[model samples]
Target: MKTLLVFEYRRGKLTEANLELFSFAAALGAQTAGVLIGAETLLPAYPGKLYLGDIVKCKDYNPEVHADIIMQAAQKEDPDYIVFIHSSYGWDLAPRVAARLKAAQVSEITGVSEGKFETGCCNGKMRRLVRPATTKAVLTIQEGAFCFTGEAEGTPAVEKLEPSADGAGLEFAGYEEPEKREVDLAKAEVIVSAGRGIGKKENVPAIAELAKSLKGELGASRPVVDAGWVDHNRQVGATGQIVSPKLYVACGISGAIQHLTGMRNSEFIVAVNKDKEAPISEVADVMVIADVMPFVAALTEKLKQ
Candidate 1:
């Protein structure tokens, strides 16, 4: 099988999601080529063919122009699958390209099972494997689902494509910065996350103390955030921030798949919950089967010493 990866560039640098595409392609055992609708100078080092469309005429993120450029590359590559990262750029451009090509489109694929793509359904409460009915398909991969550890080998053979720059009624507007947040969990080296099993709001401070003693940031599961025990900024789950801390301490978390999707990539996980069979234990390096409150208190006190 052959795959065409549509890479995105922003703010003068290429997004890291481009590397993850290679990992996904390797998992699928497919031959790969890529397209970048940005400056040729920003072209990544790849082992395969790369189609570059200069950003000057294309203008940063004109969906119509970007899709046109991708379509041109796809025509030459004739890939079975055209893949994109599930981000604001992909969410807009992938559909436009898919509609033009009349290909099947899948979004936010988390895994591959037996040559089928696995995507979350019903707000991530369930998972379903899918195969496109059409011979050609468009796909978007969820960020952080695939980790790329390998280094690039061999220089990519570069091909330049001319962009038509027909924006199709849409005007190119200046980019706006996202609203600033109180915390950026993605940068945290260590995170101690509270779950519903942490009990009442009063017990949250103990968990915070544990995090502070460990010199880590405080994180919370959806339930803890929903209950107002913590701010939404500290939420670590599908509906919140995705984090891959060096050390993650999940306290009293039952480990819903939604929650796991956010932090399962942590380098080392330590979970403290009363239930040994809790889903969180599956991903944890250390699963402490104990009550949440007393265990947290003891651990915090010991850390202080």
Candidate 2:
């Protein structure tokens, strides 16, 4: 099967997620290739074939124009599967490309078998596998679901495709930086995430103390953030900042699929919850079933000794 992996050049080079997509495509079958749409193009390190197109005039994210460019490349390659990383750009462009090609599209894919996909269902309380109704498919893979192993051998051929984009009456405006975050949790090595089960906002400092004792950043579930127990920037879950820390300590989190989807990629997970059946336990490396605040308090006290 031929797979087309579309990549976005971020900052100075292709993103790690882009390479992860290539790795995923490699396993999907043979004839793996990559496509990039930007102001300029470069040969990717992927061993499978590479396609690059220099998007002229437009410099920012215009889904209409970028999707058209990818569609042009796809027509030449005629790939059986077109894959994109689940990012702001990919989430927007993948559907457009799928519509243009009249192909099936799946988003937030965690696992893919011969003809089926695995994704979270019922707010992540269950796993649902789906099989595509068509052979031609477009998919957006969840970031960090598939670990990237650099196994591409031998230099692959690079093909420069014709870049075509009208931008659909969209104009590039000056970019404005997002407000500087108080704590950039994405880079933290260890994160202690608090959930609503911590009882009340007054108990938050105990969790904070545990985080301090562990020398980690303090994060929160959406509920905790909504309850004002922590800043919104410190929230860790879907619709919040995604973190891939070396250690993730989830305190009282029920492991809602939205939350699990965000931090399940952490190197090691330790969940402390009274409910043994919590969904987070499925992905945790260590499960400590107990009252949330007392455990944090005890851990903090013991660490002080």
Candidate 3:
């Protein structure tokens, strides 16, 4: 089946979610085409057909303008399937594309096997499976739910495409850059996450010190994020970024339903809490019963020495 994979670029290069879409598209045994709007020079080399719509300009992103461009491309490719990532951008554009094409949108897909798409249920009950109703389908893949593979069997043929005259009329008015943060989650090898048990706003720096000692990223639960102790992007939960670092240390987090949805997939989970009966202990590879602040501080100082 022929497939068109749409990805949003920042300053010309493909974003993380785009690379993820390629991985999923490759798995479906569909011929791949990448639809992008930017200078072709910014994109890293890829094995696929490439199309550029210079008119779809945005310093960052504008939903309506983006949707219009994608719809135009969908008409041009008329592929059996169109794929998007369930990211900030995908959330805005996927439904619009589906509406214009009159296609079934199978979105929030967490797992994809040979013939079925798997999605998460609220309480880890059973994963909902959706089979394609027709040969033509539109899907938005859930980011962080799947790992990426660099090896695809064959190199795709690349081609240049020009947008239609209607596409040329749209304009990118303005954009504001997203708030910058100190860490990049995708590249973090080790992560240290804290829960409400840290007790007070001032104590977060202790966990930060541990992360610093280990040269890792600091992540938090929803409460910590809501408390304004850290950036929202640092949250490790269903509503936040999903990370799969080499070693994940959970401090004071009780492993609540919402929190586990994010970091449950970590390679190694270590929980530190005074109560051995804490829910997080069940999933932790190592359980430490202690006050989070003291333990984190001692650990950080020890590591430094």
TM of each candidate vs. truth? 0.75, 0.81, 0.66
**In candidate 2, how many Å is residue 59 off?**
3.6
In the range 1-305, model 3's lDDT, one tens digit per residue, is: 78888877755456766777777877787777777766645663576666665634433355555666666667777887888877666767788777777878887787877767887554333468888776677888877555576753444354555433333455555666757756567568889987789998888888988988999999999998999987787888766777778888998998764577577777888899987777676578899999888889889989999
Query: What RMSD does each model have against the real structure?
Result: 4.2, 3.4, 5.9
lDDT of each: 0.88, 0.80, 0.74
Q: Estimate the lDDT of model 2.
A: 0.80
Q: Model 3: residues >4 Å from true position, as ranges?
A: 55-60, 123-126, 151-192, 196-219, 229-247, 252-268, 272-305
- Residue 45, candidate 1: Cα error in Å is 1.2
> In candidate 2, where is summed lDDT lowest over 10 consecutive residues?
38-47
| Tens-digit per-residue lDDT, 126-187, candidate 1 | 67889988889999998877889998667788999998658968878887764566999999
Model 2 off-target regions past 4 Å?
A: 39-41, 55-58, 152-156, 172-174, 181-190, 213-216, 226-228, 232-247, 255-268, 274-277, 301-305
Top-lDDT structure, candidate number: 1
For candidate 1, the TM-score is: 0.75
Which tens-of-lDDT digit does each residue in 1-305 have in candidate 2?
Answer: 88888987754556767767866776676577778865343545656666666655335566676787788778888988899888777888899999988888888788878777777666556777877787688988877777787654566576766647677677756556556678989999999999988989998888888898989999999988988889988989866888999999999899876688689889999999998878898899999999988888888899899
Best-matching candidate per TM-score: 2
Better of 1 and 3 by TM-score: 1
